[model samples]
Structure formats: C-alpha cells, structure tokens
Target: MKAPQGVTLVDHPLVQHKLTRLRDRNTSTKTFRELVREIATLLCYEVTRDLALTQREVETPLEVTTAPEIAGKKLVFASILRAGEGMLEGMLNLVPSARVAHVGLYRDPQTRAAVEYYFKVSESLAERQVIVIDPMLATGVSARAALERLKEAGARDLRFVCILAAPEGIEALRGDHPDVPIWCAGIDRGLDDHGYIVPGLGDAGDRLYGTR
Candidate 1:
C-alpha cells in the first residue's frame, strides 16, 4: 500500500503477525492487550527515529569517549481518548520520560460528527514533539479536532500515529492539515455508511475493553 501523505505504515512481518492475532476473534483479552503493546513498541521505534540527538562525552574505566544522547526536551504522547490510550504503553516503554495527555471525543450518533467531551494536554506542548495516537482513523473528524486543540495550546511540531486508516480519513486529514505528518500500520478500503471503516477490526474500543 502507498504511504499516506505524511503517514508511514511499519508493514513488517512481526507487526503484521501481531496485527493478525489482534484481528482474531478468539484471541484472549490478555493476549490482545499484550500484542497491542508490542506492536506499539515497534511503531514507536520508527516514530522516534528522527528524535533530536545531542553529543555527549562519557568516561569509561579505561578511557573517555564521545556519544550521542537524546536531547533533554522530551516528546509528548497524546492520545485521542479511550482507544488511543491502548497505544500509549508501547510508546512509553521506548520513551520512559515522555509525558502523556488525553483528548476525548465521541461521534454524535445522529449527525455522525465528532463531539468533544474532554481534553488535557501537557503545559509544555509548544516545546515538545507531540505524537497523537489513535487506533483507527475512519472519518478524520476526531483527529482533526484533537489536533486543532493541540495547536490552540501552542503545539507546533505534531505527528499522528494510528493502527489503521481509511482513504476518506487520510484525505480529510490531508485536506485539513497538510503539514501534520501521519503514520499508520495499514490503510484499509473505505468507510461504511455509518462512518466505520469496512473490513476494519471492528470498533476498537469495544474490542479492546470487551465493552460490547
């Protein structure tokens, strides 16, 4: 599959294998949760490849040497509510010092529009490389809105990461915010009439939490 505008899909066999397990209806909740974290760790590795590094000098028992280390400025892991929270653990494992924020929005059943219900972002958003997480991108409304909030809070550098996406959502996000880079594990076909992606793993929150 072609990479989405600024988005990248890991597409490795390990990622694909874990995703396959995630899609299986018979997978136990504990296993599914474990797989999600593992996949997120893999994705986080790619996502942070460009993280700014600084040179440092280290002294060994025998000699002194120069090395590179991550800059003191930490990245921000922002999630779009309940489902997005599932991807946070893996990111945190890679970036143990990173801060977290949550944005909550639910689709209005009648109009199929995203409605903001809650939000909380780090006070240092402007100085951090903000990574927004969501498991699925169906319509792009929620992602767009969440980004708008982040921008309003003074975040400048931003990127979005998702487990899956649809053409409609990619187009919508690109049209709305061309500068924001997007990264996804895969891009499925399109959204169904009700705004869910066809052939999607189904409602991510429902599956993750066994809420259904």
Candidate 2:
C-alpha cells in the first residue's frame, strides 16, 4: 500500500539481512547492538540524502576548483530516549559533526499514552536539519509527541528514521506529519495484542538494554 504522506520503507537487501539478525531471540546483546548500529547506518545514508549543502571553491594541490560541501550549519539529531539511543552512534558515525539532543518519553501501560520525561535541544534548531531517531515505530505516539516538542523548540526542517515500523504507526505519522518524510528499514504487518509489532524484533529497548 502506498503511504499517503511522506514515508519511505527502505527495501534494501542489506537492511533486510541485518533486520533478520535483529529478530532472532538467540542473538546476543552485543550482536543485536552491532546489527542495530549497522542497520541505523544504512538507514541514515538514505535519510540524509536531501541534507542542505553549499558550494565552495577550494584550491587543489594544482589548481582551485569549485565543490559542494555541507553548509556551515550543522544538523541536529533528536533521539527518542532508550531505544533511540542505540542508533545514535550509527548516525553520529555518518555525521560526526552533527549536534545531538535527547528526548525521553515513556508509555503509560494503563492508558497506553506517552508521557514526556526529558528534553534537551540545541540552541539553533531552526537553522539545522533535524533527524529524529527511534528503532521501532510501534504506535508512533511517542514519535509524534517528540516531534511536536521539537517543533515547539523551533525545529522546522525535519526527518524521521527508524529501523522497523508497523503499518498503523507509519500511517499515524503520515497523517500527522505528511511533509516530514519518514525513513524506515521495514514496515511490519501489524501490531500485536499488546501494541507490539507482529513478528517484529520484540521490545527494542529490552533487546538493546535488557531492561524489560
């Protein structure tokens, strides 16, 4: 099904291979972390395709030449806490110069509602491209809430990147943020009874942090 809004489910083979490893229950924590990093790296590659760039004239060893480079302005990474932290290193590896901010949210089990706990954004959010990172998009409530907070903090140009997502969550994001394109490695079938993605890598936070 075509997403009505700005959402992309990356179907690359390498992403699939890594996702498979991430799904296995027997995979060790170290391996899962490594795979998450690898997958995040691949996802970041696509997510930053439209990053702002500026042209600069550089003098080569022999002569001066005009070339394009990332503008003096840096990017801001807004990582949804806990699970999102796992992907931070991967994104940073790709864009080490980028600034990072952390947003903490937790779901209320009784109401299944998101509650914000922490937030810290860079000073100049409006000038930088913002990439919101989270490994799973089960319900998108947390992601949506985080995005709203960022926008309130003056973040405008934004993109969201995730390793795995459910159809419903993707739709929710699209419905709320049609202009902000979402990049996901895979879009899983549906959510389980408890709001987890079906056949999805179970509990990304637990898998990454062993804190179920």
Candidate 3:
C-alpha cells in the first residue's frame, strides 16, 4: 500500500505501464532498454518537482512575460556503474545540461557486499542536487556505497532513483541515509537469498546489455 519512510513509489500510469514490460521475463533486450529510459524520464519529473525555481522576464513577439527557470547550480546525474548508466540517457533528455558522474562498485559474490573500484564526480557537489540512478535497488549495497562516495565528494543534496526496488533495499538505504529520499516505479516482494530482488527483471545490466 504505502512505501516506507523516505521512500516514494512513483505510481504514474505511464510509469506503471512501462514497469510492467520491464518486469516481463520474456521482454527483449532492445525493448527493455527503451522502457528503462522512458521510466527514468518519468521518475525524473516527479523527483525534481521541488527544485528551486526563479522567475525571469522573457521577450515574446506579442509581449514580455515572466518565465520560471531552474534556479541554482545544475544537477549532477551520478550513475552507479553499469546498470545505472541505463537510466542516464532518459534523465539527460530532461536535463540536457546536467553533468554526469560514474561510480563503479562490484558485488562480492561470497560477501554479497559492494566493493568500489572506480569513482569520479563533478566538483562543487555541495552546491548541486545530485540524483543517483540505477535500474533496480536490490541489496542496496551499491546504492548505499555509491551515495557514501558521492557524499564524501561533497554531495549534500541527493536523491536516489530506480525502476524497481526491494523492501529490504529501501530499509537498508533508509537506515544509513535517512535524509536522502528514494523514488522508484515500484517495490517488488523482497530480496531473494542471494540478495537479488525477487520477481525483479533480473540483473538489469545484463538485460540492458543482453549479456546473459
């Protein structure tokens, strides 16, 4: 019914429709990629609703008018490595000028924990609102690790966006970063034994890249 604290389930009709295709086991790679991108754009709209705006006078052929524009520093779309990149194209479509950062963390099979290998972020993260994205929030190991890295790099304002999430993952993230909000198309049953989201679309990176 309701998502837990600091979690937002994006229930937009179009978002839900795309999410259905994403959850289909038989969905093709090309289609899955498209759906992920589309859903990211839709989620972006909702997560950015409260972004500060400033009014500026605009000149028109008929008359001058005031228009609202995004205020302050441009946003940073910090992608959590491979799968996170899948959601980038669509987010960029909405914020064409937003800077991008890539945070790479691979899961240790035995430990089932995140291990960072690469991290690169834009400067002045404290001044910008960073939106970290991944197709799914499964174990939240990567999401948690990614946000920790971003914060270390000075990202004070941040948001996490995903297509699907597990309740365990949401709680894990909330437990660590209570102030950072999360937005996802839906939350599935839960994480499976190996830390994968049950009924999830299965390894988003693989599906997006047709790797497995």
Candidate 4:
C-alpha cells in the first residue's frame, strides 16, 4: 500500500532483514529484544537526518578547521509508555545526549481508547524537536492522545516513530495532526477486529519482556 502523505517508510535492507526475524513467531525473547534495539537505532538515524547543523571551529594537532555540529538545544525522545519503552534504549544508543519524556497511556481492550496514567517531559519543549517512539501503531488512539498532551505542554515540533503501522492508524493520526511526520519500517495491510496490526510482529511489549 502507498504510504500516506507525511509518512516515511524506512525500508533499508538491514532494517527489513531484522524485521523479518522479528516477525518470526519462533524467535526467542532475547533475540526479539536485540532486533528491536537494532531496528530502533537505525530508524532513529533516518528520523534525525534533517536536523539542523552549524559550523564550529575545531583545532587539530597540525591545523585548525571548521566543523559542523548540531545546533540549538538537544532533541527530545518521548516514549509512549510501556510499549514505547522498547524503542527508547535503541534510540538513546544513537542520541546519548538527548532528553527523554514519558507519556504513560494504555488502550482499553473493549473500546481501544487511550487512557493516561502518567505524563512527564523535559522543559522548554517548544525549543526542541520531540519524537514520540512507540513500536506499534495499531489504532492511533494512544499516539494521538500522547501527541495532544505533548502539544498542550508546549511542544511545537513533533514526530511519530513506530516499527509497524496499520493504514487505519496512519489515517487516524494524519486526520488530527497532519503536520507531524510519521517514520516507520512498514505499514501492514490493516488492523484486526481487536485493533492489532494484521501480520504484525505481535505484542511488542509482551515479546520484549516475556510477558503475556
């Protein structure tokens, strides 16, 4: 399926290969966690490709030269609760200095509506880029809620990153926040009756933590 506007598919060979393994039901929990970290790191690289840079003078043993450095305040990675935590470590591996924010939200099984339990983020969100990381974008309910909260808290620049997405979720997110770009490895056919991505890698949090 064609990706919706404002959405980017990170289909690099390395990412696809890892994703194939991640989808295998026989894969062990340890291996699943490793792949999530590896894929998240790669996805992070793509998401931040357009970050602004400024020139800085650097001195070498033999000579001095101007070098490019990331400009402005450090970026922020907002993890959307328990499942989002799976992507947090890998992203941090790439941007060690980035600030972190957490939005604790869960989907009610019956209604698939997002419920917030906790929320915390770094100050001055308006001055920094905020990327919300969650492994799965099934219903988009939780994601929308998280983004709304972040915006209410002063975030102006925001992006959403997920390992897998359903077309419905993409539409839902774009319907409300067209400006925020979505970066993902793949978009599956559609969601199941229970709001899970069809042919997805399964419950990412459960697979990562060996929990049901």
Q: Judging by TM-score against the true structure, name the best candidate.
A: 4
lDDT of 1 by residue, 35-116 (tens): 8788888888888888888999999899999989998688899989988888999899988999998999988889878899
lDDT of 3 at 68: 95
Which residue runs of candidate 2 sit more than 4 Å off their true CA positions?
Answer: 1-4
TM-score of 4: 0.99
In candidate 1, which residue pairs clash?
7-182
Model 2 residue pairs with clashes: none
Ordered list by TM-score, greatest first: 4, 3, 1, 2
Candidate 2 vs 4: which has more TM-score: 4
lDDT of 3 by residue, 1-212 (tens): 47988888999899998998888999999999999999999999999999999999999999999999999989999999899889999999999999999999989999988999999888999999999999888888999999999999999999999989999889889999998999999999998788888888789999999999
Against the true structure, candidate 2 reaches a TM-score of: 0.95
Q: How many Å off is the CA of 153 in candidate 1? A: 0.5
Predictions in order: lDDT: 0.87, 0.89, 0.92, 0.95
Instruction: For candidate 4, write residues 1-212 as lDDT tens digits.
Output: 66778999998999999999999999999999999999999999999999999999999999999999999999999999898888999999999999999999999988778999999999999999999999999889999999999999999999999999999999999999998999999999998888889999899999999996
Backbone N/Cα/C clashes per model: 1, 0, 0, 0
Taking all chains together, the TM-score of candidate 3 against the true structure is: 0.98
- TM-scores across all candidates? 0.96, 0.95, 0.98, 0.99
Which portions of model 4 show Cα errors greater than 4 Å? none
